[model samples]
Target: MADKPMLDDTEDVALDFGAEDELDRQRRFRHPVAVFFHLAFRVASILVYLLCGWFVDSFITSFVLIVILLSMDFWTVKNISGRLLVGLRWWNYVDEDGKSNWVYESRKGKLKGLTTAAESRIFWLSLVVCQVIWLVFFFGTLFTLKFKWFMVVIVGSLLNGANLYGYIRCKMGSRKKMTGVATNFLGAQVWRSMLATATASAAGKE
Candidate 1:
């Protein structure tokens, strides 16, 4: 008889890791609308700043347009995108005693699981990249002695930097909170184990 086939008979299998990963990533962004706007405003601001001079002659007009786009990007990222995409938000307030306090919040309960890794990566990457781009613009202005555009770069830097800072703080706070909870749980377990051992020893000696 002819030798048996070396492998079990099965249907042809395709191993396209890249295509699988791309499909999985697309599925992870549960909120497509949020993702779209999160990227749209940020891209718009950067593009407008870079290309405005070619289309618009007036410096004042370019400045106003850029500022407006930056403002919109900042607001959308802080208010809508942060909450919907990453489940994080932060703000500062001053009390009557004149002490300023920063508040960081993360999603809790069942809703906490709604945030996907893909969405979070997109949110934070966009935030950090935009901030870095603005910094480059700032130094470009300084080195080239473009004083008129300095103010615009400064505004962009400040806005993007604030969001990046706030989100970073928020992320740290969440990590600390989780660490505390885990510590308390372990401490309780250890205490109970010790107490049970002491009780058993005392009873046995009686």
Candidate 2:
């Protein structure tokens, strides 16, 4: 009798099909909030780098210390669960209504896949590379005193502008395809966005 085809009456339909799973995944996604936070932090980081450039008393020591702190914080996020920072625009997927959503990536990825740790490592590596550049610039300024911190400021400004434009556009129902913009800067994955949208919408109102 095919084992009587027994049904588990206690389980909610949504729970059975994994709506909770998708929500859990979406919670990990990154969005504009993450970008804003990074932008703010990077500004402070750049200032520290420039300060390092201006003063030579403890250049290397300061740089190393800062790097260590930043790396540790990033690694914590990379390893921890539920406490990861899911920024506004860092790792986002698009919804059908075309709104952008975010996740914490590596830590979040672990919930869904086998290579979560590897992905987290990669994410951390990228962050480390950026932080290293940050420290080097500061250290250089301290030793040489001839560095142009303005350039860093300008580039950061431009990146922030682009980020703002892209994030706002995505939110506003802009019919314009966000291909070149999000792709080049935000690591935008349209397919993932579509999947996120479908899943989110289907799970809603049901």
TM-scores of the candidates are 0.70, 0.26
Q: lDDT by residue for model 1 over 1-206, one digit each (tens)? A: 99986996779988999887767855677888999989888798889889998999999999998899889888988899999998899988999999999898878887876777889899999998999999999999999999999999999999999999998888898687899999999999999999999999999999
* Winning candidate number (lDDT): 1
> What value does the lDDT take at residue 95 in candidate 1?
100
lDDT of 1 at 32: 88
Query: For model 2, what is the alpha-carbon lDDT of residue 87?
Result: 18
Clashes of each: 0, 18
Model 2 RMSD in angstroms: 19.4
Residue 1, candidate 1: Cα error in Å is 38
Off by over 4 Å in 2: 1-17, 29-50, 54-152, 173-206
Instruction: Provide the global lDDT of candidate 2 against the true structure.
Output: 0.46
